[model samples]
Structures are given as C-alpha cells and as structure tokens.
Target: MELLDLLLHPVRLRIVNAMFGGRIRTTTDLCRRLPDVPKTTVYRHVGLLADAGILEVADERRVHGAVERHYRLSRERARIDAEAAASMTLDDHRHGFAAAMAALLAEFNGYLDREGADPTADMVSYRQFPIWLDAQEQAEAVAALTPLLRGLAEKKPRPGRRQLLLSTILFPMGEVEEGE
Candidate 1:
C-alpha cells in the first residue's frame, strides 16, 4: 500500500500514534495499549508498515521458538512527502481527514470512559480561533507555527510527561471582500 494509505488507516494510525515520541514497542505492547484493536489486525498492519519501511525492527528476542520483534517509527519514512501529498486528490484528503477525526474522537471517548477522568486537570482543550488573513499572511502564519509544532513533536517522552494530541485545521471561511 502507498505510504499515505498505510499511515492514514484507522488501526495503523493508532499504532503509529502509540509509538510516537521515539517509543520502541513490540506487537504485544501495542495490543495492550490499544485494547480495542484486535491482535490480528495490529500484527497485520505492523507487518505492512515494516515492509513499507515506515517501521523498523529495533530489536528482537527468541520467544517460544519465534522471534518477538520490537519496532519504532522510521521518522523520515513515516510521513507523506511533499510530492506524494501534492498528488493526493480532494477525495483522498477528505478521507484522510475524516479518519483522523474519528481516531481523535475515539481517543477522547476512551479517556472519558476511564475512572477518575479529569479534563481540566489533564489540560484538555478543543477551541477555535478565527483569523482573517490574506494569502501572504496565511503563509507567514503557517511558517511561524511549523517550527513550534515540529519542536514539540520531536521532544522525547519523559517522566511526568503525558501524551497529548494536537490537531490543526486552516481553510478559507468565506469569500473575502474586495478590501479587508
């Protein structure tokens, strides 16, 4: 499968997210964390990702006459490159976005289902900020935001650190008037 198709899949997306922050985990570990996903499905997708070079075996150990492999995301290979992304059609973009939203909803619902769930304490947020910007201004805005987001994504997981999902959407709201 194409890298975008593989990365955007619901189950595979969850698997990749589970391994974010340079985490190295085995299939068994992923199954435990993603209790909702079936073992067979996780194993299948992990194998696909490994074959695609998006995931690489970090280590292996003999277990029950089989090799249990630990995998981590190959950072460079895990993303849809610019050329590939540009090739995606509008329908593809819609499908990818929908899949991502569904995953986010699932994560949020899972959090709410847990005991002692506390959104405030966890700093959970879902808000919209409307901005009116011309093409040039919008480009500048994204340029400024990219580094901050990239820096956060590159941080290593540490003690007292919690995994947080960050999603952003930017689009034209309505037709711009002749002059702002």
Candidate 2:
C-alpha cells in the first residue's frame, strides 16, 4: 500500500502521532501509552507504517531476552508530495484530514495526562485566524509550508535527544462574504 494509504488508517495515524516529535518508542512502550488500543493492533499499525517507509526501526535492544525495536517517524515534516497531493480527490483529502486530526488529538490528550494536566506548558501552542486570502491564495499556502519542512528533514538526530515536532495545518473553505 502507499504511504498515504497506510497513514489514512486511524490506528496507523495514531502510531505516527505517538512517534512524532522525535519520540522513538518500542512496541511495549506504545502499548503502555495507548492502552485503549490493543497491543496486537499497535504492532499491526507499526508494521504497516514501516512497510510504507513512513516509520523506521531506529534502534534495537534486548527486552525479554529478545530484540525490542524502537521505531521513529521517518517524516521530519509531514506533507503530501506534490504529484500525489495535486491529484487527490476531494473525498481522499477529507478522509485523510479526518484521520490526521484524530491522531493529533489523541497525542495532545496523552501529553495533558503526562504533564499533570497543566494548562500552561512550553511545548504547546494553539491559535486560529480568519484570513483575507482568496481561494487561489489559500491554495498556495502549502508551498510556503513545504520549504520549512524540507529544511527540517535534513537535520540529523542528536544523542539523548529525540527532537520531534508534530505540526498540523488546516485550511477550511467556505463561501466568502463581500466586505461591507
């Protein structure tokens, strides 16, 4: 299956979200963190992602006298490649976006649970804006975002540091009202 297809599944999307922000985790760790998901399901998702080149076995060590693999997101920044992105049907994009949103929310909830449920944290930011951009202008937004992602993709991981940044951008289209 395509990388996009693998990521479109909720279980796999969660697997990616769970591994984002330089978060390298083993099967056991993922199972512990996402207790609502069955261990077998987690493994299945991980395998799917790995097969699609979206996740990689970043490290290996012994657990239970056997090798436990630690997986990491291969995507330094998430993006739909230009050709695939341009040709996507509306329904394809819709389902993909919904799956992505669900994964992100699950990760955010996990963070809240871990940080004593703090309302303020250095790692969190949220904002919304009503823009003046036209539909054509909005279509160009990904071009602006893609360059930064490409730069991020080049940075090598450092020792004792898993630098994972999960970024999500949503652009909603609706009827535009004439200015008064």
Candidate 3:
C-alpha cells in the first residue's frame, strides 16, 4: 500500500500517533491504551504497518510460548514525502485530511471521557489565530516553528512527564475577497 494510504487510515493513523516520541510499544500496550479498538483489529493493523515498513519491530520476546513483538514508528517512512505529496490527487488530500480530523476528534473525545480529567491542569488547549503573512513571511514562520516542534518530538518520556498531542494545520484560507 502507498505510504499515505497506509498512514491515513483512522486506525493506522491512531497507531502512528500513539507511537510518536520514539516510544516502543507492544500490541498489549496498544490494546490497553486504545481500549476502544478491539485487540484483534490492533494486531491486524499493526502487522500490516510492520509489513509495510511503516513500523519496525523494536524488540521481541517469548510470552506464554508465543512470540510477542514491540514496535515503534519508522519516522522516515511514516511521513508523506514531498514527492508523494505532489503526486496526490485532490481527492486523496481531502480524504487524508478528513481522516486526520476524525482521528483528532476521537482522541479529544476520549480525553474528555477519562476520569479525573482536568483540561486546565492538564494544559489542554484548542485555539485558532488569524495571521496575515506573505509568502516570504509564511516560509519564515514555518522555519521558526520547525525546530521547536522537532525538539519537542525528540524529547524522551521521563518520570512525571505526560504525553500531549500537538496537531497543527496551516493553510491559506483563500484570497481575500475585494476589501473584507
């Protein structure tokens, strides 16, 4: 399957997101974390991801006479490169974006459903900002954000640290109508 096709599915997308931060996770860990997803479904999709090289087996061990594998996202393969992005049709972009949004919504809903959840204490945030920028400014803005994002992504999990989802969508809204 195409990289985008494999990464864009709701289940697979969630799996990839779950494995972000370079953390290795076993099928059992995934099943427990994503209780809404059936165990069989998680196993099936995980196998497909591993077969496609999107996920790599980080470790394996024998558990109850069966081989249990721990996997981590292959960051390089998990992304849609510029070449692949350029080749995608408008329909593909639409479907992929919709699937991503749906996954984000599901995650947010799950967060809300958890007991003892405190959006304020947890630092949950959902906000939008309007900005005016020309092409050069836009490029500069992206350059500025890239390193900060990269640093955050590379930080290893530590004691007393919690994982936070960081979703960003940046696109031109459209040409300003007449004078707005």
Best by lDDT: 3
- C-alpha lDDT of candidate 3 relative to the true structure: 0.89
TM-score of 1: 0.93
- State the displacement of the C-alpha of residue 114, model 1, in Å, after optimal TM-score superposition: 2.3
Compute the lDDT of residue 33 as modeled in candidate 2.
Answer: 78
Residue 82 Cα positional deviation in candidate 3, in Å, after optimal superposition: 1.5
Ranking by TM-score: 3, 1, 2
Window of ten residues with lowest summed lDDT in model 1: 102-111
lDDT of 2 by residue, 18-111 (tens): 6766678888888987877889988887777777778888989997799989888887333467787888889989998888777777767766
By summed lDDT, the worst window of 10 consecutive residues in model 3 runs over: 171-180
Winner on lDDT (1 vs 3): 3
Q: Candidate 3: misplaced stretches above 4 Å? A: none
Error of 2 at 140 (Å): 6.8
Clashing pairs in 2: 21-164, 21-165, 22-164
Better of 2 and 3 by lDDT: 3
